[model samples]
Target: MATGWLCHELYMWHNTGNWAQVFPPGLTVQPGTHAENPETKRRFRNLVEVSGLLNHLVQISPRPATPDEIARVHTREHIAHIKALSDAGGGDASWLTPLGAGSYEIALLAAGGAIAAGEGVVSGEVTNAYALIRPPGHHAQPNLAMGFCLFSNAAVAIRHLQARLGVGRVATVDWDVHHGNGTQAIFYEDPTVLTISLHQENLYPPNSGSISENGTGRGLGFNLNIPLPPGSGAAAYRAAFERVVIPALHRFKPELIVVPSGFDASGVDPLGRMMLSSGAYRELTHLLLSAARELCGGRILMTHEGGYSEMYVPYCGVAVLEELSGVKTHVDDPWQPLMMAWGGQDLQPHQSLVIDKVAALVARIS
Candidate 1:
């Protein structure tokens, strides 16, 4: 099992400036490191190397996605807007989303990294791959950038696969603790791609990711949203996969599986209220791998998304990578025991109700 890793140093250079968490500095908000800073991604990369896992994977290089490539999913005006702002030494892309000089170029590279990872998996260059690119992109819309995202990386890559790579059906499994509004909207009217998001209810981007927000037109019933309650943990997530996600995949029968992977659902993450350990993420990956092997010849590609915990994100990332590559390293997550023992780790009746409701939607996929 050759798992490919795609990353570029410049990915860490796409600066979001000094803002307190998600806010710009003001009289009330003091200047501090942004929650979307590079440390979380950098630490994930560092652990892969320090734990000897890096040496076991295939390394794929990223190239800048051309304007034509980006045009597949973004509007011309929106593309030019980001470039203009980036050229003028940086400015806000949207509410709570800031960028520094040269960020536009880096955003292009981030989208390109997604393309590279997808290509690696589709072309059989690697059995599976993970692109650790930055400037998280799932929150970006066709003409607006928000939620710390500048481009819809996963959406752009899925478009490229359909238009240029001759691939037909693709499915996205987004577990970001926030709604994947951008990806959902981009493919909302098309049935070729199935977008399933498991997120905290009403967490980010207000009034989004509702269970009733299924697909539209020809895409009706193709999109599924599992808005788990705020305190959902390992058992809830596992039950979601077993009951809803995996069955939807079996019904859709996609040729490739793309994950907008995010670790923000970690118990200690300041941005979310879910209680999940690295072990839970490992199990999720295991389930996905089994489904991919059975349905898609083991073709899976993942691109990084929102994960704000600088200390714990690396452990979750390493666990997923370890599962993908089938290699074990000496590194063990110190926080796992405590996270697994959290009060809500067991599946509660309330969580089961939500899962049961979403599971009924699976029969509508075909």
Candidate 2:
């Protein structure tokens, strides 16, 4: 039986006050209406309200990740720049990412939740944990913040383990629709960590996660990219995991597993064209948990990444939690009609050939 740990900050500190409609340059914020929360943070927090997940895992209280911890992965100059922006009453520093008055504290808690979850796994407190953090962290790099991400949560946790705890070998598997360019950039030169990204090609960062751009120097063959074509579903993901991620984990023999979980791959989500259903998350969770159990005594922690659809993200997250904690709260989906409206037929050979090509590409990446 696997123990489950959760960071309790899911409902706390999410878009408390109303945000202004007008954003700074290059900032694309959801139009603020009096009726809607309008902030993605608030929308993402809907997962906490799902009774199924709220009752499954134990919520461990988390404190803010200290400045030293933040500096482990991020440049000190970049940290100072973010603080300066927040201190000057919030501004957009390119890439549609906004910083409000409480941005610093919220971002700290997000990072802290991730670190605490990692600590839980490292100390044998839990076999696997899920950190339901916000201001999703995978897109934030060493110096640039983008795609609604602030601090690089997964990178900070990995670096903390490396610098302080002396846990050298870690594996970061990013399952977001967009590539984890920030994490790849941070560990591209180091051999201590292996980064695998499964995302849409040419989606967010524009030509970022190509299979050719593996890694340089000592990190060669340590980075793997599987850019599933748009509209690839469970067939593609399951095939990728069986043929790619599983073999990579077996070869790398990581000390722990870190997942940047993103639900935007759901078919109804606006972020990507993938057609995965809620059940796919459960299978993915089970597969990773199996890997952790077989390799690292089930030491795994997943940090929330990017999932923008308010209606579907919560359900997708709840499904993963249900599978992880072994708790079935059995809350039926009220929006199945909405899903039925757009849920197309199963991924066909038109899809299988693409998946076959992806499998061959993944085989070469390994």
Among these predictions, the greatest TM-score belongs to 1
> How accurate locally is residue 106 in candidate 1, as Cα lDDT from 0 to 100?
98
| Tens-place lDDT digits, model 1, residues 1-366 | 799999999999998998999989999989999999999999999999999999999999999999899989999999999999999999788898999999999999999999999999999999999999989999999999999999999999999998988999999999999999999999999999999999999998899999999999999999999999999999999999999999999999999999999999999899999988999999999999999999999999999998989999999999999999999999999999988988989999999999999999999898
Clash count list over all predictions: 0, 0
Model 2 stretches with alpha carbons more than 4 Å out: 1-53, 334-366
Predicted structure with the largest lDDT when compared to the true one? 1
Per-candidate local distance difference test: 0.95, 0.73
lDDT of 2 by residue, 210-292 (tens): 87667789887778888777877776788778877887887778899999998878887766888666777778888988898
Model 1 vs. true fold: TM: 0.99
lDDT of 1 at 178: 95
Residue 260 miss distance in model 1 (angstroms):
0.3
